[model samples]
Target: MAAGPGRYSKRVRRQQDILQILAQEPTMRVKALAARLEVTTETIRRDLEELAEQGLISRTYGGAMLRAEAEPALSQRERELVKEREAIARSAFRQCAHGKTFMIGSGATTAILAKRLAFELRNVTVIAHSFAVAMALAQNPTIRIIMAPGIYHAGEGAMHGAQTIRFLQDYAADWAILGASALSPDGPSDALFEAADVYGTMLRQASHNMIVADHSKFDRMATARYAQWSEIETLVSDRRPEGPLMRALERREVQFILAEG
Candidate 1:
């Protein structure tokens, strides 16, 4: 078992305290951290140095910033926030009425929705670009899966290219159930600019749009826009939004659904 703060080494305790502070505040000055942790400034500096060397944080001018990049990729996302995504997907799945046809997009949250639709729902046709989405539904013979042809993107677990965009342009769906790498009141955006055109085309071709994303993506930035707030019919997520994004959703009259986390 891991030792308590008193039983463990001071170095371990101090580092844990440092991470807790950083979690509340993205950046912290060494002097402030020292005072908060009731440690000498020199000790705080050493801790910061060790954390930086371990890539836990980034050293700044007289301070350290949280190393957001230290967080792992999609699989890491699935592992860390899997429950939240699963709950959000469950809430989003309620909209997936049996016999409804939709074009589902690639993303971790959407991947969860794919599993639910595959096992829990029936007789649904899904046009998707994600290999993950396709494979998730592969076991169910009742669910028809249509793959959009394109160059496979290993990192995204999906396919995308000019061909994918062309196919999306030619196709239409009852709804475009999508996901975003980042989102704001400005609407949903994609981190993969190469596939942004394909997402945009898919969005336009669909009669209605639903976005399933977690609150962590609320204010995050991405390269290209997929759909505007006005374009989306519903927003499904783990938590209700805050700040400017919240106001925008209200003004647009978008139906926002919160899933239990």
Candidate 2:
């Protein structure tokens, strides 16, 4: 008999979990993958075969690994990872009650969260450095928008510089909702130096700090390491982190929220 829809869904999730694991460690043997995911080695072998056929992963003698690729532009990134980012945005939106104020940072995921807040939240205030973020929240007339002053980065569609950092210091918010170019054991980092500085300042200006990222960012490092693990209050992502990164977050007592689509 054919597998049920539920079983097929489970297999898909398991395959994604395998990809996420490889993203962290670069490679994994079938035996180790089965043990980590709590499935049979034969199951893992079949999954690897499917993944390899899909060209999402490369197959080795007894394992699978991620193919190395350079980072894409901001426009490209926003178009990629649509489902994962939407799930992350939904999970992060739960923290935004009607009357709370937030310091929102720039990124594809954060923009999605802003759109969610605009649609579902009322009487909220958002202080943001990104033009895209501001425009997204502007859709809701009830939500007040405060755009930071700084040098505009056309590529990122965001504001960054000393002006933005200094402006953030003057106000406090309930939460700082941000995104990461890369999230590693060291913490969340960004590719832009000025943007990293702005994010770090936002973290300080808020009572609680939350990062919205996808599994693709796991175990990756960028140009600037913005905040230490302890500085972040929560992480909402498509998958729960594993290995040393999980241990690091646990040691710092960061809340890990898994977003289910």
Candidate 3:
């Protein structure tokens, strides 16, 4: 006997169930999905083709895998963190003086500071690992732009590798402005190990260290710790630290600035 419309609806629900399962385990095979959903292998193949067309997942030789680059891009991240990023950038800019050489790390907050500095500061030199930061400051003939070469990570929008480390070794700056994924009583941390290495190198190459981060980063932990609270000369954040964080920084004698937007 032929199947009714209800059977077609059931097949659609099974396809959705397969997608959810694949999301959790991206390496699931068509045969496995068919077995799990009690459907033919042909049905699973058709579902996989539709999902691939929608850019929801990628098909491999024998299975499917999630796209590493499928997450939100840097521009999207900037939009989400706009208010806090502006606050942090303003606070960092306040510390800048005319004709000072500064090193900046790659992140949305630092990108904003670079734009502000390009228009506001005069005769300043900026050493940056971010293509975005370099491009932002490039139009100003008065500002000297130095780009560090390395393997570019598009997600972080920065260049990083052994070459970047070697280049930074011979460079020195009056101040280093950086951003972090997380901040705690101990200090700044980052999601990537290579990023932590880069931030540490930037801190070492500068006479003074400043970190720009939003309040949302406070009390969170990441894969790697870049520096301790003692290493940071100042922290520019959108909101004032409260409770344990405030008390901890006070105990450590770390300078803190609250940026009002």
Query: Which has the greatest TM-score?
Result: 2
Model 3, runs deviating above 4 Å? 1-72
Residue 247 shift from truth in candidate 3, angstroms:
2.2
Q: What tens digits encode model 3's per-residue C-alpha lDDT throughout 142-217? A: 9998899899898878899889999998899999989887775656878777778889999999998898888767
Q: What does candidate 1's lDDT look like per residue over 1-261, in tens digits?
A: 885777458788789889888766655689999899898999899899998888776676687765533223555566667889899988888875543778988888888889988888678788999888898888789988999999988778788999898887777888888888766556777777865777787778888788998877775446566778888889999988875578879999999999975
**Which candidate would rank higher by TM-score, 1 or 2?**
2
Q: In candidate 1, which residue pairs clash? A: none
Instruction: For each candidate, give its TM-score against the true structure.
Output: 0.72, 0.74, 0.71
- The global C-alpha lDDT for each of the candidates, from Candidate 1 onward, is 0.79, 0.86, 0.79
Q: Each model's number of backbone clashes?
A: 0, 0, 0
Displacement of residue 249 (Cα, Å) in model 2 is: 0.9
Please tell me which model should have the higher lDDT, number 2 or number 3. Answer: 2
TM-score of 1: 0.72
Question: In model 2, which regions exceed 4 Å deviation?
Answer: 1-70
